[model samples]
Target: MRQWTTGRERAWRLLLIAALAAPAVCFADGDAVTAKAKTSLNIVVGSREARPGKEVSVPVTLQTNGLKPAVLKMTIRFNPAYVSYVEEEDGAAAVGADKVVTAFELPSGSLNVVVAGFNDNAMNDGLLFNVVFYVSNAAPQGTIVPLTCPSGDGVLSAADPLAARLDVTATAGSIEIICKGPPAPNPVAGWFDAQEGAGLTWGESAGAEAYQIYRSEMNDPATAEAVTDWLPSTARQYVDASILANLQDYCRLYYWVRARNAEECASDPGGPVDFVINEIPDAPSGLTATRGHSDGVLLMWNGVPNGAEYRVYRSNNNDPATRQPVSEWMPATFSFMDTTTPAAQYGIAAGCSGRLLLDFFQYTYWVAARHTNGCESDLSEPAQGFRGLPESEAAGVLPERGDLTAWASICVLLMLAHRAWKTRKA
Candidate 1:
């Protein structure tokens, strides 16, 4: 009996050892699968400056150096009087997860967040969740709304239920409630997306730390809070490149410039400047196409300042209306090489081959400058080039199809045959 008991004990010990040697499971893919680095759960409370009765939505973000958690639970604590809890939004961490279960009691000042996923699919690092709170109208100016994450209430675990995580931490941030009304308004002077550059020049504001540039589609209002990060006061001009790609070719864009003080107070949006984004850039200068090489045409032009690129158009006719772009868009370079070989076309019934029957083809070329804001400049002066049969063989080639070399050859053959027959009859 004693020997049998010893064997059972050894088998149990071996099973335990094998279990401990197994690799831990992960719930997220990519290089950040292993939880080898530290993980921090931070409360990102925004909108420090707010008017009374305004709603503030503070986000809870999960910041991790290298760790990826499959399940996370955090509890937030805040005062109920100054800022009452409105509701919870799980839309943040619910992404990529099977489901996110969140439970919180309003007016109690404490909320809990729980996010979990199955298998190797879990929410990556970013905003874990959002908690919204309302500032009381009666709340006096300079009121303080404190937010905190209590100790031991935060839990982050790996996919394996049995796995333990000991390197996780939590941080808390707060929002200061203020009722400072909108600052005085300062109007924007002028703005343009032209040869000089794409930006706006505005009047300076006294006691301003920085200026804010705001934009909206045509006929829409630009709000002060909608302005992007503050620009240094000295940066009186703001060059916006995104407008070039987003706005339509001829659409009107509205802009407003405001000043932000050191206290984060935003002045009223100033200009309803109807800055047009679709204006064409200045026409390209010195447009010329040369037959320098045997196989290609060389096109060169002078560069346009603040120009996004150049468009090259080609047509058999000299009329600008008939010309079509060689390519959709090209870089802001001053040169392009066209290697398209001219081919011959044949129509037996027509006598003259319809295809550029002339030994040499004349092509008209035009160049245009394109600005960043979807605007295009007018066509440059018309320039002509001869392609195909080398210049040596293209002495009297006309632009019309019937007078081409193909028709001339046929006419000469017929006349010679008649002359020969007449001579034999004589």
Candidate 2:
């Protein structure tokens, strides 16, 4: 709040003493004159609320002893930060005041007013003059704008000889500056993709108790129908899985957020942000496998358009449910070499069946294209191929491979060696 003061406290007191020193009426020669009637003057101002950038009036009223007064004067001191003086006018034109002087000075925030009557009889009790003020837009909310008599002096006085001593009481007037309402929240726009869904996030508002998300398709302005239900203040983001799912790839979505305070006052919608749904690339096609001989199987596929990378999965059989990723993440290549060597990066399991058949291998392979935004397509058609020697010609030491070939190979090799040993023994 701006600090303001009227620096006339001492001077105001001295002036008030001088103005009230004389009895109500004095002779032309300055002889002491006693008033016939006792009278009082009151400065009345109503208390009210005022908005910034508006004009407000405070009336200074004079209540006489039912007798007319020949002279009157009023002075008002105020806080300049809250308001500025515009003008002042007589309380009633019918009374026909003789002469009136009004002066308003800044920095001191003071208004001095004086009026006199030209008629022979004393004037009736009524308004002295109204002081008009303009409430400043920068006025701090809840700050009071006061119009008061300085040092309780010069509030009201009369020169009517018929009136005796006058008793004056002054009441100060005040207008409180009330803020319009909740101010608009500053919103920062961004997108969020989480396990729950994809969405947009906005910055929080200082006075907001809740928020509403509004979305527009094709960059159009948002409508009420597109607005979400009021969300708790804690929710700074809104996710609608269906919106992204339903929209065409690369299409735009415009969105904004409105903040609401506890009083149900909602701020205007914030600026809009753009959100584009990205399309997932198609799965790689034309996948083919070749023999890697003793190493492993070699797999290749045609690159999918718009594919940022490719994911490879291998399975012992054609079933995808049995498939597991060959590596932790997708490789940025269309060709992958599945190897059986201990140092092979793909880490293909050497023993699929219980029997350890080192020579021959058959594997199923497929590929899926992945987008930069993490969107992935379905796996391509499975391809079956072989490497090394076929199962029928296999004649080597075999462990318990899951398939029966491992056991059959081990038994057949042992049988052939045993037959040769028997012939030699005979």
Error of 2 at 164 (Å): 8.4
Report residue 45 deviation for candidate 2 (angstroms). 2.7
Which lDDT tens digits does candidate 1 get at residues 48-135? Answer: 4455678877655543333355666656667777787777676554565664757575456876656665645455555565677788
Q: Estimate each model's TM-score.
A: 0.32, 0.35
Best by TM-score: 2
Error of 2 at 200 (Å): 10
* C-alpha lDDT score of every prediction, in listed order: 0.58, 0.58
What would you estimate as the lDDT of candidate 2?
0.58
Candidate 1 clashes between residue pairs 3 or more apart in a chain or in different chains: 244-372, 280-376
| Candidate 1 residue runs with Cα over 4 Å from true position | 1-47, 106-108, 153-172, 183-426
Across residues 134-231, which tens digit of lDDT does each residue of candidate 2 receive? Answer: 88878866788765654433323334553332222343356676654455556546674533444667777878898887766544443534557889
Residue 53, model 1: lDDT of 76
